[model samples]
Target: MTAILSVSDLTVAYGGVTAIDGVSLSVDDGEIVTVLGANGAGKTTLLLAIMGAVPASRGRIALRGTDVSRSRAHHRLAQGLVLVPEGRQVLVSLTVEENLLLGAHLRRDRQAVRNEIAAIYERFPNLGQRRHTAAATLSGGEQQMVAIGRAMVARPQVLMLDEPSLGLSPLFVSKVFDLIEEMNRSGLTIVLVEQNTGKALSVAHSATVLELGKVAIAGPSEALRNDHRLLEAYLGGAADIADEPSSMRANSQ
Candidate 1:
C-alpha cells in the first residue's frame, strides 16, 4: 500500500540551532509508526513541522500523493492530517463536551458533527460522564482522554501524536497505549512520538530512533527492540527497552 503520510528531508531551525535535519519517514495506511528519542532529539520538532506549526527550513510533506509542504496547519487538518499535541492542551475553561465540539469547529455539517461527538462519548465513557464538567477539573489521565477525544472529533485519517504518555501514572500510560492500539485497529494511521521507548516499541509496527536532528536507527520494531547497542547509545541504556509491559504487548497483538 502507498504511504498515507510522507516526510522527506525535513528540517527545522531556530536561529542558529537546527532541531531536525534531513529526517524522512513514511506511515503506511493503517500502520502505527513510532518515533523515539531522548529530550531535544528533534522528535517534537519533526511533528510540529509536519503539522505546519513550525516552519520547515527545508523538505517536503505529503499526504497520500499530494505535496502539502507549504500548507497551513488548518489546511492540513482539512486534508485529514491532525496532530494531538503534547501537554494535553485541552481548553481548560471549557466543559469536556464543549472542548470536543471545538475540535469540529471547521465543519459545517452540524448534525454529523453532533453524531461524531456522540460516537466519541460512546468510545470514551469517562468523557461522556463528565461531558458538562470543566476540562481543568479533570485529572491528568482524564485530561489526556479529552485530548485524544478532541482529536478524534476532528476525524483525522493520519493522527500524529506527540508524547501521549508523558507525565502520566503507569496505569494511565497503559490505558493510553491500549487506546492507541484500539484506534489503530479501528483504522487510524498513527505516527507516534514517544519517550517511553519500551511501550512505544511494543505497540509500534515500525520504529525510528532520532538523535541530534537525524535518524540514528530505523526498522521493524522487533529488530530495533533487539538492537541493544543503538538503544543504549541513544536511549540512555539497553535496559530501557527491557521492560515490555504485558498490557502493551496485548494491545499491539
Candidate 2:
C-alpha cells in the first residue's frame, strides 16, 4: 500500500535556530508510526510542520500522492490530516458536546456528525456522562479525552497526536494509550509524537527516533525493541524496553 502521508527533507526554523532539520519519514495507510525523541528534539516541530501550523524551511509534504508542501493548516485538515496538539486545547467555555460539534464544522453530513459524537461518547463513558458540563470543569484526563474526541469528530484518515500522555497519571496514560490503539484498529492511521517512549513503542506499528531534529533511527518497532544500543540511547535501556512485554511483539497495534 502507498503511504498516506510522505515527508521529505522537512526543516523548520525559529529565527536562526533549526527546530527540525532535514527530517524525512512517512506513515503508510492504516499504520501507527511514532516519532520518539527527548525534549527539544523536534518531535512536536515535526507534527506542527506536517499540519502546516509552521512553514517548512525546505521539504515536501504529500498526502496520498498529492503535494501539500505548502498547504495551509485548514487545507491539510480538509485533506484528512488533523493534529491534536500538545496541550489539550478544547474550548474551555464550551460544553463537552459543543466542543465535539465544533470539530466537525467542515462536514456537511449533519446526521453522520451527530452519530460520530454519540459514538465518541460510547467510547468514553466519562465524556458521555458529562457531555453538558463546561470543558473548563473537566479534569486533565477528561480534557484529553475531549481533545481526542474533537479530533475524531473531524473524521481524519491520518491523525497526528502530540504528547497524548503528557501530565496524566500512569492509569490515565495506559487508558489513553489503549484508546489510541482502539482508534487505530478502527481504521485511523496515526503518527504519534510522544515523550513516553515505552508506551509509544508499545502501540506503534513502526517507530522512528529523532535526535536534534533528524531521524537517528527508523525501523520496525520490534527491531528497535531488541537493539540494546539504540533502545538505550533513545529509550533509556534494554530493561526499559523489556519491561513493556507488549511492545516487543511484531505488531503492537
Compose the digit string of candidate 1's lDDT tens values, residues 156-176.
999999888777777888889
* Candidate 1 residue spans exceeding 4 A from truth: 241-253
For model 2, give the 10-residue run with minimal summed lDDT. 244-253
Model 2 / residue 169 / CA error / Å: 1.6
* Deviation (Å) of 91 in candidate 1: 0.7
Cα RMSD, each candidate: 4.0, 4.5
lDDT digits (tens) for residues 26-94 of candidate 2: 889999998887667888889999999988989999999899997899999999999999878998999
Worst 10 residues of 1 by lDDT: 244-253
> Residue 191: error of model 2 in Å?
0.1
What do the candidate models score in CA lDDT, each in turn?
0.86, 0.85
Best by lDDT: 1
Off by over 4 Å in 2: 235-253
